[model samples]
Target: MEVVKELKVPIDYLFDVFEQSIQSDILAQTGKKLNENEFTGFEYVKDFSKGNQATIQIEKYERNRAYYYSTHTDKNKISVRYDVHSLDEETSKLHYSEEIISNGFLQKMNDALVGLVWGFLKKKRFKEMLNQIEQSYTE
Candidate 1:
């Protein structure tokens, strides 16, 4: 699955926000609903400022794109990439693509049964991250 949004910030600024968000608990709270504990390993990293947690990795970074991967303990993994396309010096389009992969039979069943809700929650988190970046632009 994939999620995309148009952000009104420069690509450079988006990268900065991403780096900042990872360093804090913002990423730990990504895709967080009112009371869900489905996501793990995003918090408590020894050096999240570098974006490598127990189950998350940030890589393939360039001027306009970055890839992030996160895994749940039960063999469910999410690989997502952010592509930023500059429209002008001050605006850019953010395209987020994600793929869910699992090697466990239980995980596959879970995905088939609750994937839609999970996708919605993840999309909500992506928007929240964009909002965070936009807010930081004002500050």
Candidate 2:
């Protein structure tokens, strides 16, 4: 899945927001504080309801440009990337993409059906979050 949005915020401000959000999430999940230099190769486990958990690793990090990460779980491996491009001094384009790979044949078949519904909901929620960020800057 992929999405692209033009944001009203400057590239630098958007990237700062994105970076701070990730840093806050990491600190909340792992109780470890990390600076930008420590982002690449950092690994942590994120727990979900019902005891489900995934190990997340930062695979790529480029300040104000790109952030890519992967999550590994028993059933699937998921990769997510966010790329930011400057459109003007006060505008930016964000490209977001996610890819999921199932671990087994049965899981793959099951994911095909489940992914459709979940992906739609997830995309919607993500778009709303982005819109909120954009709105915050304008306000």
Measured on C-alpha atoms, candidate 2 has an lDDT of 0.90
Instruction: Write candidate 2's Cα lDDT for 42-112 as tens digits.
Output: 99999999999999999988887999999999999999999999999989999999988999999999889
lDDT for each residue of candidate 1 in 1-139, tens digit (9 for 90 to 100): 6766777788888876665555454445454332112222333333345554444544445545653545444456677777778888888788888777876898888876777667778678878978887877877
Candidate 1 scores a C-alpha RMSD against the true structure in Å of 9.1
Estimate the TM-score of every prediction: 0.67, 0.93
What value of lDDT does candidate 1 attain over all alpha carbons? 0.63
The pairs that clash in candidate 2 are none
The models' CA-based lDDT, in order, is 0.63, 0.90
TM-score of 1: 0.67
Query: Where does candidate 1 clash, by residue pair?
Result: none
